[model samples]
Target: MEKKAAEKRVQELHTLLNQYNYEYHVLDHPSVPDAEYDQLMRELTDIEAQYPDLVSPESPTQRVGGEILSAFNKVEHKIPMLSLGNAFNEADLRDFDRKVKQAVGDDVEYVCELKIDGLAISLHYENGLFIQGSTRGDGTIGEDITANLKTIRSIPLRISQPMTIEVRGEAYMPKKSFEKLNQQKEENGEEPFANPRNAAAGSLRQLDPRIAASRNLDIFLYAIGDFSETGATTHHDGLNLLEKLGFKVNKEREKCTSIEEVIQYVQKWVEKRPHLPYEIDGIVIKVNSFVQQSELGTTAKSPRWAIAYKFPAEEVVTRLRDIELSVGRTGVITPTALLDPVRVAGTKVQRASLHNEDLIREKDIKIGDHVVIKKAGDIIPEVVNVLVERRTGEEKEFLMPTHCPECESELVRLEGEVALRCINPKCPAQIREGLIHFVSRNAMNIDGLGEKVISQLFSHELIHDVADIYRLQKDQLLALERMGEKSVTNLLAAIEKSKSNSLEKLLFGLGIRHVGAKAAKTLAQQFGNMNELKKATREELTAIQDIGEKMADSIVSYFENEEAISLIQELEAAGLNMNYTGPMPVQVESISSSLAGKVVVLTGKLEQLTRNEAKEQLEALGATVTGSVSKKTDLVIAGADAGSKLTKATELGIEVWDEEKMLEEFNR
Candidate 1:
């Protein structure tokens, strides 16, 4: 009788958990407090443990939480997670409404919610417990980020029901959090994150849950999938049911009885969005009835039942006081518009990148022209379209300089490329930028060696070329600002450590034209070492996949240069690795597997394993680990809340495996 009673309790817990999951994931309405849900989950887990026979496959306690994944395994989505059709203006919205009306009749209701400006994620829940989370990568596959998702405070560890469900939502960093993070990064002498969206995206992609946790990410579940068993006749009812669960739904969501109401809501939010703590790019409008949505169906890339109404870009008219030319590390000469101070997109706009001479000519922008400027993606300030009416005859046509701005060397525009480049290897500006790039995170990854330190080194004549970095003495470094004995030692140690890094890093650090990180890695791996690469002719170089003739010529020319030869010899003499060393070995077999081909995402905090170690282990095993969870993900290794990825995965019916099971498979 006791056994029977316990079994009955488990079943009850399962049902409750599924219902709550549906409420939270599908409908985005979580009714219960997180604590109560957690308590119930603990009880269910205890009951299941006491009577192992009573535990079912769909139990809420069986999520992927026990062991942290060494890395996420990729899963290909059966169905592509297509992008939404956008409604940029009132006319577009009206057209969308008309289409919906034509398909589902004029009586269709609408649900409007903020279109979050972070990463789009999918979550999968089975039997009411959170499982896998993924990014919307190419809509077909994405990295599994189950571990990172588990760290979100608002995401529930378990659900209230035993039904399998999938939910989708936007994962975003609040504006306040973004600001604080940027402040801290600046204080630490790190480059500040460009925008809230980028910050959120970057934070979510981190392999370590601890790093993700530090970012303070948040989410709002919006849609439900696999809802046939729930008897939710309409989207509105499904949302109501979701509210009864334990998910965090956006409070600003509204139900509109008609398209007019939806438009009104969208309009209202466009004005009211500035007051919100998070960045919202637009409003998502969807048909509220499941029947109506089915009737409306979908297009190649978007659902006919829903449309995103993008807010008009914020534009402000400002005077172009002067045009400045700046040379980047890559030797690309960019034109800058120094604007009269104006605020656009909640940020002060003082300068904007003109991109190149072609853009300047295309826009016909002059030094004294009154222009309208706006921030694209609310991050990069750009001159959209010139206010031609405001242009005065005094506005002079700006011409690019025929010579290098710094060294006055004759500039040459390479064929097939737009911008003119200064080929002088010793140009002071280019050298400074090159040094900074060499020590950048993606390059040598030298800690404590930043732009300021490089500048100081250059000023003191302690370093001129890239090889000079290897020759820094302790006494010389100690004389620099903020440098002490310990700091100097640490810097030296870092420099020494970087010397042994794979040839790919060294190749990237060289700042060769058109050779990005991936290209450098490919070149290193294909050639085996710098010597082989330098010996290869242009024809041999271009034979590799993805390397074009232009890239080949550039690489050949760079290697042929006497300065480059000297630098390589000096670096080789300093004990820097000049050849490819294959991939890093797996620290333990438990992290390597056939799962290497799969993309894996880690969401929540792990009781064991650092995120970096896990990523390394996975990579060594031949798997590609990505930060975002998308449809292409093979599995979501979830822990805790697991946020949007968990919801999206469930919606897509993707399989989610627990950490213990993953470990067992790996061991097997």
Candidate 2:
């Protein structure tokens, strides 16, 4: 029980447990029995408790998770996590191959890896010790999930070589783990996860790392963020190096000398996918040589040297038992097809979106009709078609309802729109949906105010509007079905915290007709304050790029409404912050007019500034930042590894500027 003896024992336990963990979780071969491993872990935990100073983050006991996180902090990826282009057919693969060969020559080799159907993650190591891990948020930025990621036993706390590195991978839940977890969920009267991918994602995103640790997640470290540190010549070499460093590299990867061989690998996996212990949606084909990859370069979004060959969607037929209608926040009535329960794309599907009345009518969907369904992009189930031959004579033709299903208001199809809409401002369904949107993650982000709680509050008449949420009493919440003292306290604290959010969150939470998160940010930056925004005319609003005439009209009309003005005053009275808290907008007169009125697009990674900073700078200099390149694009700021946008810019004969040129222009 002495400090010296405890320290030595802790170190020994670390070595033994880490090795055993690697053997069991990564290598799938346990040299020791489960009881033995557990006993050692318990000893380590007890020793650490006895000599608290001897405990370290690298200890095996730390894998069980520590404290709960209040919020996930934003992490900027030093190397951008660029997405791969996808190929759905043999022709697409051949096309990708031809392009790769054309750019890097036919002497190229390709490494084929299984495209894991899970969450993408980046792991950062400093001198071989796992420092941080994050989700692939918007490529350049991600949410810090180090605590959650540490729970995955396959992920080593320390690498072998004691070198700094950033590696990328896919974190997943195995089929067995997913089944067991879902079974537990069902037994507990909780909704089971739709698929392993969803379950994995949900586990990793949990505010409590203990929840993630319980999920039994796994990972496969595939690509190194930078291979220069290890002197790896090829993608295959990098994978081998990762494996040597105590990382779980997928052993199913193959090195193909030709595109034909790559095609065979893809085809082989397509047939063998169902048998794998974990789910794989596709095969990722990458040019093997690092030199060739550099030669080929990337487009705006994806790499030219790599493509993911997505498996064909699984299709199944189910009976459309009934048509269900729901009212959206915008009062648009959406039709959903309630079908007989069936499994497709590794998930149970009992409902598919019918989109709108036009889609329903065009497909001629009827009650009790057998319909073919498939997952679009392996997520949303949709009605591919109807099997007319299998339709029973008793099938009833469906029609769009003439009234709002919730509020009993008459529905009308607005001009230039195909769907029926309920214009009733006070409709209970719209109010409920709007409240849900207002408290969403991208909006006010009140932590414990979930959809279920919101629905309960609405039904109980404890909250009628978003502002009413702030006025909620603790006693009122405590009286609700599931709201415990702790739950009510946390909910109230979260609601209080949201009142201090920047103007963009408030603007997005308002649910303006045509304004999205991006547009909301833009507006917040431009106007600086809610008072200025309220005074903006249609002409002034449209002058800002990305704001169209329709959007401008919507904004102007929204501000003119007395009810909206009253609601804004109410929110302001509730101690909500009204000023923009982000970077200040550049003054028009201070910057050069050279880029004035030009449609500009930024691509790839910039060394000096983030994509957003560069975008704001460009916009301040009178350049309009757009996502895509077209003939209308006046200029393109191409950065490191610039992808398809750069190619398209060249193809269209548009002006292209490198980072240096852009910086020089900004200086001028």
Candidate 3:
């Protein structure tokens, strides 16, 4: 095809795909099947590949996201995003209504919309084209997350008309998406996000846009930031306009004629909130008319015209059957309350975490006692309080175990720590948990070694520790239940592949107390080899950045144990790599180094090295990279859309550099 023909085809494809995206994401009605969408996308990608200049920012292909960002640049909101005051009861609602009536007169109406439990966001569009998106940080300033926001399909890239406006919405993970994401996180041995709101916030804030895209996030535009520019006389009208402009708007909103009607709406939703597809913590009540809202005025932090009615946490009474204790890989003995199965926040409740012995005593919970239970954050089940009035003399007081539940080793509470720990390295339960951690993604990354598989192997006595994994034979794995020939073969291959992992993997897999993944990587780079690290004293370990006294002591104590020595030797005998093969931490101490002795702060997006890479580079040059700007900070590396950090640096009269200047120094 000719260049002109291809260009025309590209334009046609863009309009078609945008429509499809709006239907599937914004409208929740997809006209074309996913396969057809992919085919058209492929065709457009081919045309763009043949002609690079044809690739535009607004192209449908740009939604896939770009390379990892160095840092999020900050954005200052043109119109400060005010938060809403909350109403917990009818009295509070009446108080809010009274205030609104006092300011705007007796005739008033309220628009009630679902208060989405998610991250607040600001989307900016230029000439009907989506340009930038950011968080509502501190109301006035936010982090620019345009690349990440673009990945959310519900957000339209273009509107119906050529208009520049800022829209506010809540970016949330649906209940189903949150559950699926938590399942994946658990399978990967990662802590599950507390709720949909937190999960959405964490996903959107990820420096890698690809990570955010994978989380399957959605959004609902509620209010326009610049209400006057939108020409909407009422809050309900603004929502309609937003929907007409190709933005996803929640359809469950209602316009109530009076305060009593508003209260009724809130009461109705409080019971039905859990049934919704997504999580909503409360309902937002706003005076309907723009004139009424303006007349009602605002507080320093919240708008008097609008208030949030938070749903009271649903609590249920269940019998506490028993208190079960589980030993973690870190040897922390955590108590769990085993309760009669009851539903809370849409999930069945069986067990809730009892953080420490102090909590148990403070709550005065007893076995056989009726207890109130609720989902702590609509995700984690927790014991709220005991129904002492219903408790009879038949209830038995629960006692904390003095010894490890699995290994029977004496438990001890460490100084400055609330957890009772079993410090014995050879505890059977600890070994099993450690093996599970060893094959985790951040550790050895051994495929096909899930907790179930690891537990099976542990039960059969085929694997005792991390080293025993490398020594496993095909015959032994085949003997296990459900371990087929192909399964054993694949498992062996993944195990063999992990043998060549850099020293950091092995360091983390060792499960040394207080040594997390980051610290393990630092130690691996600092020592360059396991033997060097094993020989390092506490003083030598503490010399590394981010390594504090506790971590240094733990590392020295871990390697000093006889079992630790034997494990390392066994690992080496099985032909595992023991050398650091990643980017070495710079050890240059030259006084003339450009970034030497400087307390540097990095902010915004860098096109070249990643944020961690940049930090590592600066550290190598003897620069201390701090998270925030202070009077002690000597320089600030500013990239595109640098926010509060850049402003503070300027105010402090500190030196600032862009990515280009930073790279210039890096090359030197």
Candidate 4:
């Protein structure tokens, strides 16, 4: 065909294909048969191939996939993508309503939307043509995954109006898509994703856009990132404008005039959430009017005009078949309830932590008894309470074992501790658990070194300690049951790569007593090098912010141990990084603010600065920002509707300041 004819034909196909995509994906209605759409797409592809110059970025055929990205580039959001304050219960929602009414009056209206449990995305457009799409990285900066995002059919390549805009939405995997993906993963001997949220996130983050395309991801545009260009007066108006521009806007949204209406809508969804094709964690309630939103203002972390009402963790009753004990890296004997499989909070639950003997006794748990189970914070499965009335006479009483289940060592309850501990330093369970922790995602993060692989290596005696991982021979790895040449090569590469990780990773991997991931990072920042940390006196460690007396004592004890010191030397010999590579700790002497060296607690909300922004600025001046108010709190900066923390601060006679006062101090 000639270039001119091909160009006209290509434009016609673009219109037809984009309309079909919107009809099928966005509107959930198809105007034509699949074969018709496929034939037109093929014709367009052929034409584009023949006249290469006619191929354009906005062509519907371009949605198939793009060239693999070497790395995702950082994108800074023009307007910061602030998070919403959470309202977990009715009372919380009522309080949020009261606060909103106080600022915007009782004439307020709210737009209630289902908070889709998926990855947040921002799509940018110029002249109604899709240009870039990014992830919500840290609210301010995000990664550009434009190529991957283009694969979602629901996202339009070109809008109806020829105007520039940026829209915000959520990219998600439907329930059937998630199940099919997991099934394929299981058949291929790959680990399945935990939930739809994780699956959607993993799909979008793929380096190859083709992989993302294959995942069948969909999107629902909710808000306009910049409504200034669209002439939108309210949040609801912005959503309507997005829908008109060929974006997939969720249809279940409702406009509520009163808090009662919002509550009813939220309550209705709590029961209907499970039936939806896509998962939703909660309902997002926002003041409808843009003017009202601006008038109410925002906090340092979240907007005061909007609040997310998180659904209570989904609970289900299951029979407790047995009580199992497992030893941790710290040798704590934790009891887990082995329950009959039941679905809760988007995942199947068969095991729930009983935590300790005290919890079991307090809850009156027994084998073969029906117990109410829930995902604590929608992540960890735990037994909420026992259905005492539903218990059968055959139910067996559960008792704590006298010895450690793994190594048969005498279990003893430590002073001021509720859980039983196995004190045997050489316990295989302790060693194995420690080895697993070392290669975990937050630790050394050695890819391909998963729990099952670690178990195989341990059973074969090819690996003993964390250092043994670095010393692994390719031949030794090849000899393992399921290990192949490619797997072994990849494992070795990952192990080698981990050796160059920052000092904080190694510190967290070491499984230090009383030292969490955050504390490990803090300690690494404070000391800079492993040598300095090893030689740190208890007083010097305690003087550092976030390091308490107990934590300092634990650190001192860990360093004093001859075995730990030997292991450290072995790790250093393995060529692991020993110096901190991340951002350095702020020196108090460098900052002129009086807030320096003070334990400051930020409560309620701030209007001028975001909660995170305020906290960050405070920390930059060497002040410690803590969550709770206590007697040790040197200062309390309270914002709108100062809560219990402010009351406690006043009762404790601690210095308190309003947002204005705090801002004044910050300005100085």
Candidate 5:
């Protein structure tokens, strides 16, 4: 009887979890608190662990993402997730209505919703339980992010009823959360995320679900998969059903009888979007009836049954006062435009990026010029154009500096690069910026070592180079204002922990020019150690896949410098890892010989190998795998419903292969 009761309990837990998953992933309505959902998941996990036989493939406990995906595995979507036609104005919306009328005749109602500014995701539910969640990558295939999706509190662990359904929604970061995250990043001396959308995408793509959970992401369900399960027959009714099932459907959604009403809704939100805590790029209008939608059909890329009405780009005019030059840790002089205080989107704008001397010349911007500024995507403040008519004759033409503003040394513009750089490694400005970059999140990721701390350290003559950071004593740190014993201890601990970071992170932290995180990882993997990387000739470095001529030159030049070599020796003396452990396996020599210097794209699922595993194999074989499929792509590994990429590849006559062929050729 006890065994029977245990089995029943397991079954009940599974049912409850499925209901929650459906409500959250499909409907976007989470009835329970985050803590409560977490508790349930824990309980389910415990049960599954206790009685391993009771665990099934559809269990909610299975979604906690495991194994750092070296790459994303492709999934062939059963239905193509097409894009929506865009409506820029009310007239465009009316034209859409006219088209709908022409196709389906009169009597078509509309479901109007806030078009969330986020990455689109599709959730597959089986028997009213959440099974899998994937990105809408090219519509036909997507990366499986089931674990990351599960971490979102708004996603349910289970559904209320037994039914198979597919739901689509927008996963976004709240504006408040974005601000908080950026603040934390800034305080830690890390580069702020570009915007909430990018933040959300970055968070969701993390290998660790715990990291994603801490990001405070939210979602809003917009549409049902096919509309056959919900018998109500209209888009509005389907939304209601989704809400009833515990999904977080958009409360702002409305049933509009006409396009005029939809336009009013759009207008209302355009003015009010900033007031909300989340970002919405536009409004989506869908034909109410499934029958009407079927009649409207779809275009090659988008659907005719629905249209997205985009809000006009938010712009505000401000005055450009003066251009200020700031030197980075790498001795790059960045020009910033000091602006008269003006309100752009929701934030007060006081500065804008000049980009480079080229941009200044292109815009013909001058000191004391009245400029029209706008936040690009409501995030970055940039001077769009100068109010040339308003410019007085007294305005002075800003001249590019021949010397470094900080170090007073000769500035050099490298071949094919725009920014004029200060080659002096010992420049105070460069030291401060380089130190900040060394402790940045993508690099060593040292917490509590901020700009103020670095500045104070420099001012007091406590440290000179990156290696000096490790030599900092607690008593010395305590001498600075606001640095208590505990804070000093924490800072020291973080710095010490950073020493154990992988070779890739160290490579990035070194501040090599044109070498980003991806490039650093690639270089680390290829060379196997910093010592090997330092000894590599320009010819040897350029021979590596994705290592362009410019990058090779930069690497060679950096290593050739006595200062750089001495710094590396000092860092090695500080007990940092100077060798690689070969995280990714080396590919067969035969495969490496053939695919050398070629770009390949992996699409769709491989039955035998995980996407990450495949990526490692390919990378080891001297092939570069890019995320997107382009005309430059030499080969595409097509696996089931390869989508537009496959179509384009065929059109371009790019070589295509299946998983079986890939496995056979690569000997995986």
Candidate 6:
């Protein structure tokens, strides 16, 4: 094709694809079949590849996102993404209504929307092209997640009119997408996400845009950020303008002339909320007029003109028939309340997590007692409170077991932790659970070996430990129930594939005490290999930043075991990887700076960094950052609405700096 022809074709395809994407993803209508869309996308991709310079940033092909990011950069919100004050019950909504009426006069109208339980994000458009997108991090400054946000097809790459705008929206994972994603995770031997909200957040935070693209994330543009340039008079008008500009505006919104109508909308949605494709935690009520919003203004964190009415979490009364105990991979004994099968949060509930023994005693939960049960979406069912008034003399006080239920070993509670644990390394339950963990996603990640299959293998004596996983033969796998020829082949292939995993995966897979995924990665990156890691003393281990005394002790203890050493050798013999293939550990610089060589305690909401991200940046600058306040704390980097740590810092008369100061120092 000629250059002129290719350019015209590329631009045409961009327009066509964007239209189709909006129709399918936003409007739930597609004029073209998926195959037809794919063909056009393929044509566009080819044309763009042939004429790279002709491809614009707003091209539909750009939705796949660019190259992988090293780390997310902080972006300052031009207009702050203020949160909404919450209303839990009818009274709270009425109070909010009365307050709004007082402030904006009796002629106020409100817009009610389903408050989607997802991450809040800001999308910036320049000349109608989507230029940037960021998270609602601390309501002021947020992480630049442009690449991830671009992958959400529902977000228009370019609007109809050439206009500059910043829009606020909820980026969410649909219920179907969430379920599919979790199923995929389980199938891949990975941990499933807790809910749609978490799945969406996790998806959009991926360093690789390809990961986010695969997640099928969608967004609902609710409010216009700094709509001064736009001729939108009301919140409802802004939403319409957004939709007209090809953005996915949720249709499940209503304009109410009175607070009574708002209350009715909230109540109606309280019943209708569960049926939506995405989770809605609450109904958001906002004074319709932008003038009224400006009049009411905002607090430091939230807008006074708006209030979100959260549905009281669904609670039901159920009989706690008995208490059950189970041992985990780490040998921790966890208690569960086996209840009379009852429905909570749309799912049948048979068991509720009792947490540890301390919780049971604290709650004074008794067997055969009627207990209030509650669950919010995919969250685990919990005992809200025991119905003490309904309890009869037949109710028996539940006691925690002194011994491991599976191994019959005497359980001991570790210092600082609440649960009783079996410290015996050879306990069958621990071994089984550890084996499962070894094949888990953050570890070696051997697929096709789910809980049922792992349990079958263990019970049949085909595997005793993580090392035995490599020794399993096809015949042994074939002997298990439901093990077909293809499944056996896939399982064997997956096991073989896990051998190439990095040293960090192996370290985490070992299930070392007090050594979590992050610590394992740290240790692997520090030592670089199994041999070097095993040689490290507790002192040497503790010398590394974030490698606390407990973690160091655990690492040394794990390495000191003869069986552990033998297992490493066996893994080596089976051709499992031992060297860390990930990035080397970052060395703390000795150069002088405001934060250098200082003991810092970070508190409250950080605008620019996640807690780990902050710790990493500070550590890189040679700061010994700790979690809590103490006499040794040199500086406290207090953020917006800082809590007890900030108070403790004030009490200690420690020098304090806000996020701005911290960022300045970080930049320096």
Score every model by TM-score. 0.69, 0.77, 0.67, 0.80, 0.70, 0.72
Q: lDDT of candidate 3 vs native?
A: 0.86
After superposing candidate 4 on the true structure, give the runs of residues whose Cα lies further than 4 Å from its correct spot.
Answer: 1-13, 30-55, 60-111, 135-145, 177-195, 198-216, 225-238, 255-263, 285-308, 473-488, 522-528, 531-570, 591-668
Please write out the lDDT profile of model 3 over residues 228-254, one tens digit for every residue. Answer: 977899999999999889899999999
* Reference-based TM-score, model 2: 0.77
- Angstrom error of the Cα, residue 430, model 3: value is 4.1
lDDT of 5 at 331: 74
Winning model by TM-score: 4
Clashes of each: 71, 5, 0, 3, 26, 0
Candidate 2: tens digits of C-alpha lDDT, residues 1-668: 77888888888999999999999999999999999999999998899888888878788888766689999999998877877776889999999988888887779888999999889999999988998999986566789999999999999999898899999999999988998998776543245777798899889999999999999999999999999878899999999999999999999999999888998898888888878889988899999999999998986666898998878788998999999999999999999999999978776788999989899889888999999998865667899999999876999988888999999999999999988999999999999999999998788888778777888899999899999998999999899886789978988998999999999999999999989877898999999999999999999999987888998999999999999999999999999999999877565567567987788999865634457767876887877787789888999998755768899999999999976567656645
In TM-score terms, candidate 4 sits at 0.80
lDDT of 4 by residue, 212-309 (tens): 99999999999998777678999999999988899999999999999999999999999999889888989999999999888988876678999999
* lDDT, candidate 5, 1-668, per-residue tens: 36677689878877776766665655657777778778888887777777788877557675555655555567667887766767888889999999899988878899899988788899888887788888876566678888788877677656556878888889999888887998877664446777677788889888777778788898987778878757868888888888776678888899899877888898899889878878787899999988888878886557889988877667877778899999987777889999999866545578999989999999999999989887754667889899899976989988879998877999999888889999996788988888878888778888788777777888898988789999998889988877778888989999999888889888898889988777888899898889889889999988987788989999999999998999899999999987665476355455535666578888864433446667766776778887668777999987643667778888999999876566545542
TM-score, cand. 1: 0.69
Q: List ranges where model 1 is wrong by over 4 Å.
A: 1-70, 75-82, 124-129, 159-164, 319-321, 330-332, 340-348, 356-370, 376-379, 385-423, 440-462, 470-505, 514-522, 538-553, 581-668
Clashes of 2: 5
Candidate 3 — which pairs collide?
Answer: none
Per-residue CA lDDT of model 6 for 1-668, tens digit only, reads 99999988887888789889989998998999999999999999898889899878888888886699999999988777766666888899889988888887999999999998789999989998889999987567789999999999889889999998888999999888887888776664456776677788889899999999999999999988887778999999999999899889889899999878988998898888768878887898889999999999986657899988867777889999999888998889988999999866544578999989789888989999999998733466889898899966999987888888998889998788888999887899888999888898778888778776788889999988888999999998888777789989999999999999999899988888878777788788888888898899988988986788988888888778898899899999999999999765444464677677788988765534556767777877878777779898899997544768889899999999876566656655
lDDT of 5 at 655: 95
Native-to-model Cα distance after best TM-score fit, residue 231 in candidate 1, in Å:
4.1
